[model samples]
Target: MFSASRGFVPLLAAAALTGVLLGACQPQGAEAPPAATAGGPVRILSAKGLNPQAGEASPQGRLLIGRGKDYTPLNEDPKALFDKLEGSMAERRKTGWAIVEALLEPQKLTLDGKTYDVPLWHTWYEGMSANPEVDQKIKLFIAQLAACKADADCHKSRAEIAHEVMAQSGTDKNLVRSLVSANLTQVLKQSEGFDRGNPEDELGQGFTLFSPSFVEHVLAQAQGIETCSNKIPWNQAPPSAGQFSPCVEEFPRSAVMVKTNWDQIDGASPKVSAHATDAAAVTAVLKGGTWPKPTLEPVDPSGIYTVQTTDGKLFGLKSIHISTKDTREWIWITLWWSPKPDEDFGQDRPASLARFNGGVWSHYKMCVTTAFNETDPKPWGSYETAQPALAAAIKASYDGAVEQRNPAPYDKVTTWCSNPNLEHHTGNGRTNCIGCHQYSLTWNELKERPAYFSDTYAASMAAEYPQYGRARRRANFPAEFAWSFGMEFQEQIKTAREDQGFSW
Candidate 1:
């Protein structure tokens, strides 16, 4: 899986997705976008669009998300990101997160009479300890395995794997401590496990052994940060040019997912949530003060707003050329949350999640990609529209002559959850999540870059999207944006280092 044989791809069998190209990007063939029944699901394309390039999976696809038959494909740069994100969210909601589970190869560890499905990090000790005594025992274990393989009637015992190690240590106590505690030592902390399959490990799964203190820090930061939320229209689209028309900041709290004493589910109340996570407390902790003690309200359930495509067609599929295997529409349900109960956002929160394509992007319709109900009537800001002035300010600030926060870097951070799973494989496509800009820690990183808040940068971003000359995403976004895993790592590292009185 590490090498490029299987496209350098890992095991992804559990998804509705057949296979990913990851070669040259999936290219869109010459064809009009497919059409959904006026009120039906959109039609999906076949998976024949794979083009294997030298070192990249160049998937060129356009998911039709607009009016029936007259689909707007999300094939271009900037707008593509938006539409793709929405598409991915929708897919996840459709599949109830089987797509997410596909990303993980959970370890089946047998310890004591009970088995624990430990995080990947704990698997490190299952191999050789690099000690001769241990290696000899490992040899014996291998021999036993071979003998059993030769005997069709024989079954391998789970404890047999642990025997060699436990025998040397005399008890399971030392082994358990070493596996959990010693593994955290600085040297081992930097092992291959830390970086391997990062995309999967960072899916907000709450599997990592996060420090108690770090979790608190997360809640604190989230509490102080203001919130910006938008509810999907129950009957119509928001008026924004991006297709999210007539959107507003506030919706009934029912629009937010309800948590139970037992678990957290991802829908408005009535239809038992398709996606459920027992880690509601953790999610609330991560959400910080915004949730306000964040307990799930009584089952006095809020209702759900189902997204039904006109003509039973998947606008996403019609707009793009992709695998017919991919599902067209999900049994989609939406929930939005924000800290501002009073419904006022005055630059207090990073709205990394919402954008209306109201800025320079507003002028281009075909290039603007978005879910029909996710955006607002006008998401653009004055700063994003100021070209010459913004461009000039950016040049001056980047050159180091001026320290300007004048435009004052401000972007909203929106979160999304979905099922069915978007075919984009960066992460488990089906799940709750923050916006991509914040997902990668890019928003935080961009703040550190020069003149990032200037209008020029916004224009540059718009240019990379469809309305402008949509170009491939610039490298800077990943190099800097830190979300999910990045956020955790940063906070954990700082906390650990400070506690050590300046140890790296």
Candidate 2:
């Protein structure tokens, strides 16, 4: 994941991007006659179009224009961009060393004006510490970039940055080169007189800076940091039942299998009940050692299992189940191994549980509100446009679930329950729709299971089970899901927490 694949390539690429940007900024057309004044604020004059201002202010009072165009205030000056870089470096330097300590401090990052001492910062650091050289170089580059006034200045400083980053790139010279090149390109783009060309070009370059490929490299390093940080014993006591702490346990022996039943069971009579029974059956098979290999099987073509179930009884159920009750009912199955009490489960398990529960609520809400009233302009016009409408419906449904007690929209079941057999359990009071959905096995392990339900299951399931698919496809689904579920969750969490007075 390190950006610098080759030692020299990134340096050269950085130089090239700088050149392109600088070329774009240069005055275009014939040389203009000497202006009466030295020209206010080194305005960039170009026929090809100058780079837009880097920050809030314009260069001097006048805008820089094309050689033949009228004299207007420049959107930005090279010096101003350089100053911004310097300012960012200063801020980082002032706070960078203290990042770990600040992050580890209780009640640091705030949400909705409330401080959350969640392990998010620690998790981030875990991911960051892996590639110390990359982190060091990036930090150093930030420092240098902040101080650099021109491309040449950056180039001078980059040698040191390159050396630092290169030392840590391992044997992957190509990766090192690529990273360095990209960084240089970014630095150059930040310079004055660089031309971005068309909108597509500008967008492509801008996005690249924030792209997953870039973020992944940073995150991969962060993950390494997480590993190291986790190894370093904390002085604080373990977290309590509901509060987020580093004491969370990892689940052992977890797997997901997709199951489909060709038999068309009555859609009305508790479809998921049959599926749950089937899932139990599959679990029994896997536990009984029926399958020749210890691989997970599908409860249905669409359902996923971690362990092989005998006779495929659980392997037959297809649709996921949900009851429209105010109370929550979910099955927690541990699928992975971990020695440490708190570090055994996958990272995403809690989130997955929460999402699954929330998703059920969402579907139920959709069914109740929009099921009978099909002619009411169909909330979002039609199923084709149902995505956004579904989202709105889910949010409204969550609100409904929390407010009404009697004449409940849905029946109440168990208050909250997890399989007592599991080694690490979050228990009832603290658990919510979001907490369980955050598990890694729910989405990560399940994603690997095949979809036996539809020929188009790969495509349709691609919408849900992204982890089983190609990298690019997997990358795209989260954003879509976030858009689909995120808005609803935000609204729902607020209402649920307020009504329930729940703490996380």
Candidate 3:
């Protein structure tokens, strides 16, 4: 009976195994798996009240893992937000004149008794409209804070109060000043790393704090300075009084007009000769009236020519012009009598005239061409191409002159015209074509401030050349060629004077 029971057991086990395999291969009716919740906690449908999903250890139940009902979203504290806004306002103020003007509107505040109108103010305000909810919240906060009766009340909710203040017109003087100062400080800090240390380098800081024009205007107002004239209070002065001379013998009272064709002038550049031939040519090129043949005005060889103007002040004649091609372009003509011999008086006169006409007048034409070409639709085909070509032509002419001379060994030359302190050591290193003639400040100054070239070349060049469109926008020219010769000349003079035991 026991053996029979064992056989039956084996048969039953085999049959169960076969049934299990068949069941595994057969398809059973099954429910589809649940889909994933987008950016939300996963949930299992099979859990209940002890709510394992709510517990950190539960994986098979609904979990509120992020900012859902069980989790609260973090809020930026009012104080921190207000502080950030204040910082932003200040940064915008330093960037440009426009922002400063907007910040200093009449209703808001004034600096140095002047109010600037910044167009950017409206644009900034309008930008806030893009976020109506935040804008409304800011507006409400501001209204409540402004309505507060005391500082104690304002401090009750400091962050709310600050938000209100920033959203409003910013009329409080102390607040406005603090904001401005803070913005400037931030700009100064960020600007430390800039190699150039110019205003453009801090543009981002400026825009964040204030608009461009407003920043410039406010800074100017703060400094109590004017950008146009650059004249300070201490610099204003009247013309000097004329010196009187007693009548003397030996010196003739007669004056003779010196005239030479621009082409005949020894120092005149070929570029100059191409445009102007004589005084008339110069006047025509400059759009000034033709200069008449000069007749010397008589003077008491010793007594300078004095004119009693209608204003009743007797002033010595500095110079007078007989005529000009265009009266509009005529600046002024002044003649100075030579205190020394007449021969010594005219030593540099011809060269000076040619320099003035070629360097100044031709430069003006180049500038006009540049401006027109920049604005023209067909600029490349127009005068635009002419500028670089002309510059090249001028450069070639200068090179021709230097090449014609006998080559001086670099070691034989005591000093380079550009850097007199640095001596050339090798005979092989001859000064190139550009090195000799590229130090022309007259031409550089014209490029810097075309409008002011005729009236104030030196001053304009000093102010604008370092930050001019070309210098600021394009790659910097090589220092060897771009620096003014005046500096080199001054250095040479200083060295010579020191060698002679004289103070510069």
Q: Which structure among the candidates has the greatest TM-score?
A: 1
lDDT string, candidate 3, 1-504, tens digits: 111111111110111111211112311222212222333332111111212212223322121111101111113342343333223311111121121222222221122232111111212211111111223333343344345533453444534454344445432111111112122123221122434333322111211222222222222121111111211111222122211111101111111111001101112221111111222322231122112222223222113322121111222222211101011111011122322212211221322221210111111111011000011212112212423432332233223223323222211111111000010111101222122212222223335431221222122342432211111111111111211112222233234334434321
CA deviation > 4 Å runs, candidate 3: 1-302, 309-313, 320-323, 326-334, 345-504
- Cα miss at 396, model 2 (Å)? 5.4
Residue 54 CA displacement from its true place in model 1, Å? 49
Q: Candidate 1 overall Cα lDDT vs. reference? A: 0.22
Q: Model 2, 219-313: lDDT tens per residue? A: 22321222221121212343443222232221111111110111121222312211111223223322231111112221221121111111111
**Alpha carbon lDDT at 225, candidate 2:** 22
The alpha-carbon deviation from the true structure for residue 63 of candidate 2, after best TM-score superposition, in angstroms, is: 13
Q: What RMSD, rounded to one decimal, does every model reach?
A: 24.8, 26.5, 37.1
Q: What TM-score does model 3 achieve against the real structure?
A: 0.14
- C-alpha TM-scores of all predictions: 0.22, 0.18, 0.14
- Candidate closest to the true structure, highest lDDT: 1
Candidate achieving higher lDDT, 2 or 3 = 2
State each model's CA lDDT, in order.
Answer: 0.22, 0.21, 0.20
